[model samples]
Target chain A: MASFPVILFEGGDVPDSLAYRAGKLGAEAYPNVEFLDVAGPRILMAPISCLGAGFAPDFHGFIEYRATDQGCPLTQVMVDAVAAGGLCLSACTASLLACDPVQVFCATVLRLAPSIDAMMVELALAEAVGNAVIHGNLGLKSDLRHSLAGLVEFNGRIAEQLRDPTLAARRVQMTALPYGDNGVEIQVSDDGDGFDVEHELGKPLEVGAKSGRGLALIRKVSTHIEGGRGGRTLVMRFLPAG
Target chain B: MDIFTDSHSDGTRFTLKGVMSFRDRDAFSVILDAVNQRAGAKVTVDLTALEHVDSFGIGLFLLANEQAVGVGSSLHLLNPQGDVSRIFDLANLDAILSLKQTMPATGATARNSAPPRRIGIDYRHLGKAEDGSPCVGFSGRLVFAEHGHFQEIVENLIANGGPRVVLDLSELEFMDSAGLSMIMIAHEEAEAKQIALVLRNPKGAVAQLLSLSALEFMLEA
Candidate 1:
């Protein structure tokens, strides 16, 4: 079977701009991503800014382009190929701060998957970071935010916990990898005690419920989701327009 | 943070300078108190010189507006530039707070002075529609970064609102879910005020987003 993320060339010819940049950077492949497309992951390549070219819905892999192809409008075309899905051609990492995780995720997503809906990513990432920072690292509960007075207490407790040297230093680790043919997989892991994944995922989405909305929202938007490392980590897969 | 307050018979204009963060909470509370003191008056918070604001600072503005609303007073924020403007745009604060687009000229106003530069989102209050409803045109990308300005423009158009208002999104190239949420919020808010918020001419990705988000009911026929 082919590896999950393969790379293919448009009409079997790598764009000259991409090849030149890769050669200048001393890379035989794309700068920030690794691939094993052969009886391996699907691999595809497109021109430097040719976001419109060669993204056949059936192809599941990163479309190779130069790092210079930053803000091209690739969403409409990709969304049209929903069944075929979309792919992330790049990857990035950041030291996550409690207050800045969403922004970090947003900036990284914009760089890696410019065609994806960033707000959707922002909302999902925000929930993941909140789960990591408040529930995992700091050992706080969602019940606090459901009440007005509890929210104040929760904020105070968070501030106090962050003042502790060890707690302040804890960071969430996130990694983005290509999933299936045309989706991005985001793995977010926290340093705190993990929760029960089965229990969490099994809970039915409650209407007008405030405390457990994050997991539900993540489940709704992601193509697939699973927990690992005793529930300390979550892998969320997102396809275009989801 | 520094505040230079100028009080007049009709209203009070507070010029805020320096960065506003959690440390300025106490000082901001005082400004909120002053705003409450002037009931039924026009209050302007000039932010031209204000360089930055964190989420906490933004919360203070929301609180200040709440206080102003309690006393039947109106608060208008003016001329936010740089990072201050960017933060406001990210949060979509203009949906609730009144934002002034132009500064008052001291003496003369030119006939054909160029319009202010379009930053993250380009918007123009296109006076009135043929049907007499207030019309506004929005072009370019509508995403999280442009939410505040987008809401502000729509809010201003609906201020002295008639039976309905028209939003022209024909030239709008893109809109994310955040932009869609802003339209929903605008619709709800307008409905509460007994005004119909009409969206017209959403093309390209903007149209797809609206449809994908299941908000076709919001568009005007």
Candidate 2:
């Protein structure tokens, strides 16, 4: 029998329906699961003790709540993971305020493998996020980077998209999972129209070619790459030198 | 990215610090504008402090080189280090640009008092071709920084009314995508002028790239 704990806050903004759903999901996933309401004074102490005992919750569900404050236990857990080089999964809304997803993802991975080549990691992340931002969310063509006028137009389009709330509100999520003892699997996905991954992948790199180098460069740096969601999602595996 | 410019009687020196990528497009444009303003004046760009560069940055260098030709001046790159230097090597820019390990001494007094230019390229005119048309010979690497000089030389040859312009690349050791682009542009210009632009003796990686791109038609036996 497996057991899991679920935290429920009384004054938190999480809806009751969401909590019910989380409970149902947990019960269906696990045979023996306990939902712990940490709102009461007595129950709060119990949750704190569980956390002190290194009982990491398998599933943490927060609905319609901001967890930016350090006081949030879940947020603290993520921070600790980043500092101690542990597994962390994060999802963020695609907005200018969220910063570059590539930079954030690379920074986290760098913490795990400090000896890895920084430039290689940077190039891989840049290519991934660039594909997501320009081709995915903004719906810009890669060939636009071929000429000066086209590049200018591309930048202008990106700037315009950034200003539109409807476009900027789309979500881009990145997940860094452990592959092996010293390998990492990075997945980047965006909510946009997928591209022709097969066509892009098949194109050969030629001299004097203006565009179509980003994916090639990414593939060269990563150990393995796979595309999904009609090419809206990119999964790259990198092995850092031990 | 930070661009600092210092102008003297010898030339205008532009020092770039930080990563040169798409994010620095506006800043790079400003540098291009400055290069355009100083037409016919020698321009030197120092990239020792640059940490990284992307494809856009490489394209921008080619664009700036083209602009430098329009103004009748030449541009040179100095002191590329780390990944910045590696990018140039990977792009095989040595054959197309005038890349030097250090700058030339300006004057007797300046040679001792001033700092060496670090890396510089010298442009030499190779006189007329077999048909009495203009022949330009480049001896060093021609990377992004040397595109300006390469363009200026080609434009000057075109202006001389040569039926066929021969570019002697026997001594060139490397040529990157930017260099290839410049050559292609020159070829187009020559075609427009009804003149044949011939690439003479492209060796090593330059030959490989040209052949791979199926641009061997421009090569001369």
Candidate 3:
């Protein structure tokens, strides 16, 4: 692969100029970009997360984070890491919802670049920070019931839809079920000998793990977790983010 | 994809309106970084309009989650429409990333407290399957030559429980070490949890995978 610098951008709609200029000027990847619009807060981390992993970086750094209708806390976390690392960072007034105080934590791997164009594609630079903060507080900060309710509200408003609407809708309908103060029910079913729990849960769901760390994070934070081939179920008690 | 933002005096909120996949990482990265400047503020990611997500899509989210925590803030994903939810579930990301639904046009945002989502097996609590038992019901496909849908299977089991688990190998046509390991992982998980992790009747390709691993005897022996 050609040696290229990691270009992390704030998530939002990238104007044709920056997108075109970046691509034309040798940009390796976009963590989140869509169409001509780079709805971002994405990463072009270290040319590659690992050295010599041989990822088909095909059209990297072009992630399309479609959560504009709401807020995304994850976007802020990713930005803090990328920008905090050694890379170029930029932002846009439009990308920001408002100016609020936010702090993101990540191991220092990439550089942080603060720019105006960055905002156009940035998810948390200005607009997304608050959402991330709220995500941590929604459920856990309140009583158990409120936490669960906050979770449902969280799920209903931000999480799945932004990642993949089709999948999010299907999952919400198939898996999640609410039963009053009891909590929210999440069903996970599959064909294999009931999937692997040791690999996905109780442990970090990062790289090597089949399902990865995100799975572990969601499950851990959730109130309850369950599932099986005969049809499994994940019952989240709906606690606020702790 | 377009970017939408809702601003408040204290902070700002953003909604990304488009398909979330590998194609848009660059754009997404920039936006997420910008959000980090503000510490401990609330931001929301609305997905009532998202369409797809793959490995790259998953990566984008992982990137965002990392950034959210850095500056003392968090990410909030909202209103996943369709296909989007399945992507998360398949990736088992539903556990970490919130997958919200649009309350019926009923306009009743049932702010009620959440209840525990339960899994009551419809099948009887049948004991383990017989040796070389013929596999029966099966759904999903091979993810890897060895493991295939193994990870997904375990994810489901974790969120839900089954009286009897059926690893219908009838439809399965291949296997490998990864595949076998996945099965073992699931088996172990069930045992540890004291749940009945039964490998239903096995045959053909499905049977071959187990036999090759010499797990057949251990499974039913």
Candidate 4:
């Protein structure tokens, strides 16, 4: 299961086998992927590329991946997911972002809003790193993380329901966002901001904790996977329905 | 509107026949006083004929439930509709209270979710985004473009009431971060402002989102 599932299909084609396997996994998966420039950058779309594809009892938590365009958009997927349901996690920053907001579901539904980000970076940077670390040797690891995150969100919802029976009747809004190149940098934010991240590990932890679990996730959702985070950015268009 | 109540030695079942809202909080308060004298019985509420329910209705139900349980009683809801259920759903009471599609024969319920009055609070609008993306207004999904305003919404609410308020989002079909932040900001404002802010009558997609964000408790008064 992927940790932070994408809520929109930036654009790509899902391999037929992966689609079938995802369906068997009790999640709505896709085989055909499409490519588009819905957000910060554009790249090849792959499986689990569309928005509003799979949802859980809580309607929050989604997984997404990207091989290029840095990690700006990737951060956005997590942000949007968190806002919808109060939690989100991502592997590398290079992911999809530029897509229709309505097409994706915000884990939580509310009336108040800030505005939309309109900036976009049209160039591809750090090709070698993205292809190697992210898409190359360990793609499926990240994919599974994204998928699993969705399940976790669902499970959490069920638990919450039991504690407060009244909670089971609330509403959920699911939404996604494409991070601007370099992401707006939400430093000095709240403590929970670094939930997915091990804030205890100081500012930047290299390559993150052990790769065993991550590698396993890569193998599960390998086709739509990529390796490495391009140093420059991690934002790209999401193919939510591939 | 007249509210019908059936109090027994083991349980108290109330059937709301007409409009329920804030205006009846006093009447409810008075009735609960008498009911508590003979507590320990379960409380079951049946809202089969309740025309509408509001945030105040949610408060009534919660108050009644608390009151009943304080006296060794429980609150049970039976056969609630979308409007009423939506309010309960948003409050996350479905899990807290014994909400049933059909009335259970026994329990301690005071039919509090039924609003005490109907002030014609019915005003709905649907809208869409610029990208041909489908969205309804008010209840439609929200999309905030900035983070600063989000901070402001909370600050403002703080100025208005102690972060003690409930946002009724069961009616909304779509929502964005900006919208979510608005609720959060309002909740924060309620906290700083010392107002009670809570989300009531959440259902389906909306409830899932609130719980996942772990904001259910934070938003509740």
User: For candidate 3, what is the DockQ-based docking class?
Assistant: incorrect
Candidate 2 lDDT tens digits, A46-157:
1111211111223222111223322222232332322233433333233322332233345456655665655566566656765676667767675654443444455566
- Please identify model 4 stretches exceeding 4 Å from their true place: A1-242, B7-11, B103-221
Residue B56 deviation, candidate 3, in Å? 2.0
The DockQ scores of all candidates, in the order shown, are 0.04, 0.02, 0.02, 0.01
Per-residue alpha-carbon lDDT of candidate 2 for residues B1-221, written as tens digits (9 for 90 to 100): 89998988888888899877656778887668766876577878888677656545765787787788888778788876554554566567766555555743221210111111212123345688777877776554443324325545556657756578788776554454445655666666677889888888887646754664566877886
DockQ, candidate no. 3: 0.02
Which digits, one per residue and each the tens of the lDDT, describe model 3 over residues A1-242? 22333343334444444455456544433433333344322343221112111111221221112333232211322233223222111111112111111111100101121211111111111112221222221211111112223323433443333344332212100122232342333232211123344454565322223222223433433454443432222222332222
lDDT of 4 by residue, B1-221 (tens): 46677767666667776667666666566446644655556667678776656555665777776777788666677887634654465458876667788553211111112211211222121232233322221243333222222343344334433323334565554333224444554444355545555555666545544543444664334
List the candidate numbers ranked by lDDT, top first: 1, 2, 4, 3
User: lDDT per prediction?
Assistant: 0.57, 0.55, 0.36, 0.36
The candidate with the higher lDDT, 1 or 2, is 1
Which stretches of candidate 2 lie above 4 Å from their native place? A1-98, B1-221
- Each prediction's fraction of true contacts recovered: 0.00, 0.01, 0.00, 0.00
> How would you encode candidate 3's per-residue C-alpha lDDT over B105-206 as one tens digit per residue?
111111111111111011111234554322233422232111222344465654345444555444333332333445556666665666555564565545
Better of 1 and 3 by DockQ: 1
Residue range A1-242, candidate 4, lDDT tens digits: 13322233224555444345434432333322333223211111222232222232333433343333222222343443443323332222112111222222221111111221211110011111222222232221222212223323433433443244222211111222323332221111111111222221124322221112222222221222222123112222312112
Docking class of 2: incorrect
Clashes of each: 14, 11, 229, 180
